[model samples]
Target: MERFLAISPKSQLWLFHTALALNILGMVLTDMWEPMVVGAIVTTYLSIDATVRVRYVLPMKKVLRELEQENASLRRKMADVEQSSAY
Candidate 1:
């Protein structure tokens, strides 16, 4: 599941659009609206999710990584200070 969700946003969008297109074609051939409606709903949800992830989640992840690195550096500096003062 994690691996499946790890797909890039561009690829996910392509998949959503492709699914919607297939649903549309299915509707045209069968004269049914159910599949098309369901596809549109699913596509809308996935698109919104991808947009949120791209706009917010990715940047926040970057910030988190930087913070983690900074935290590690600060910890090392504190340890060095403690060692120096131990003399």
Candidate 2:
């Protein structure tokens, strides 16, 4: 909004918010349809990808590292898989 933008003029999120607001305004102001739908889809995809990386891909890395350790143990690269050591 004009108030938020006035307060923090440099924020990228605010910039995106402002653009989205302007996009909606344009749809009503010019009575366009396709552009508004495209705008909605773009923001939706960005949000979905952000959610997926934070929720799944990051945790998968830890599981992957564990699997790599297990695979290496199966190959006998480690000295002793039974030895007690801090993970």
lDDT of each: 0.76, 0.62
Tell me, by TM-score, which candidate is best: 1
Per-residue lDDT, model 2, residue 5, is 35
The number of residue pairs in model 1 that clash at the backbone is 0
- Over 4 Å off, model 1: 1-6, 17-30
Tens-digit lDDT track for model 1 on 1-87?
A: 123567776687677667766776777888678867887788777766766776788789999999999999999999999999999
The residue pairs that clash in candidate 2, if any, are none
Cα error, residue 41 of model 1, in Å, equals: 0.8
Clashing pairs for model 1 are none
Instruction: Give the number of the best model, judged by lDDT.
Output: 1
Residue 61 of model 2 has an lDDT of: 81
- Residue-wise C-alpha lDDT for candidate 2, range 9-49, written one tens digit per residue: 33534455566667777778886779787996675554454
Stretches off by above 4 angstroms in model 2 are: 1-33, 77-87
For candidate 2, the TM-score is: 0.45
